[model samples]
Target: MQPSDSQLTGVPQTVIIDPNTGLPQNVVIIQQPSSGPKIIGILIIIFGAITVLSEVISLGNTISFGGLFLVLSAVNVIVGVGYIAGGYMIQA
Candidate 1:
């Protein structure tokens, strides 16, 4: 005989069937929600700003390390800005 209309199709045979109705019971599907990326970007920017400020402050103490600090500070700022831009793009 052909399958009845009430019979479940494309459903796993292992599913628990209702005793009275002869159909799957208590089927639940769970899904995770998407989260945005913005806080990380802000943190990166803040860190970069702090590094640059510390480098500037150190410039007054020693001349030998000033060049290295300047380079490091610039790199930090650039990376931080890139992260912020990336976060904005992801949000959009």
Candidate 2:
């Protein structure tokens, strides 16, 4: 009979070893996810949502600026969409 390979390490499996026996253990360790990115992503997503929702008010205010107002207001929407995408990308 021959020694088998570890699921994760394949050959010469030295990943999770039993300290007392000094032999590889069939155990897998999973670490908790960091909350930093989640927190930041949520905040950024919220800010993006706010910015997107507030466009109506912003556009109203910019109406007096005449022709350039649409372009300027569109910029705000684009930025808000970018923030939303950035937040999702950060999470990934």
Candidate 3:
């Protein structure tokens, strides 16, 4: 009996031998690199900061005009903080 020529190619076979057990083990590991999530997190943080700053400016204008909208400004600030926290959490 003779082994097929394909068996002599030395290519990494799907069934790998386990050094400890001397038996075939079916396990495959692959590594991939991605940047989408990091970019999204950074963008979220930047937009959040911009939203917070714009809200602050609007709040100042409202105050100067004697318009009562303090609650709205506070809500905006809170939302901005939440966005920043979410972005940082995603990055981590």
Per-model TM-score on C-alpha atoms = 0.37, 0.60, 0.64
Clashing pairs in 3: none
lDDT of 2 by residue, 26-86 (tens): 5666999898998898889889989989987777678877688788789989999999999
Which candidate's TM-score is highest?
Answer: 3
Off by over 4 Å in 2: 1-30
After superposition, the stretches of candidate 1 with alpha carbons farther than 4 Å from their true spots are 1-33, 36-64
Q: After superposition, how far is residue 44 of candidate 3 from its true place, in Å?
A: 0.6
For candidate 3, what is the TM-score?
0.64
Q: Is candidate 1 or candidate 3 better by lDDT?
A: 3
- Candidate 1 vs candidate 2, TM-score winner: 2
Cα lDDT tens digits, model 1, 1-92, are 78899987685657778887776876466877445345665565566566656656766554565777667766765775675566566555
lDDT of 3 by residue, 70-92 (tens): 76777888999999988888776
lDDT of each: 0.63, 0.83, 0.80
| Colliding residue pairs in candidate 1 | none
Residue 31 error, candidate 1, Å: 10
- Give model 1's TM-score versus the native structure: 0.37
Give the winner by lDDT: 1 or 2. Answer: 2
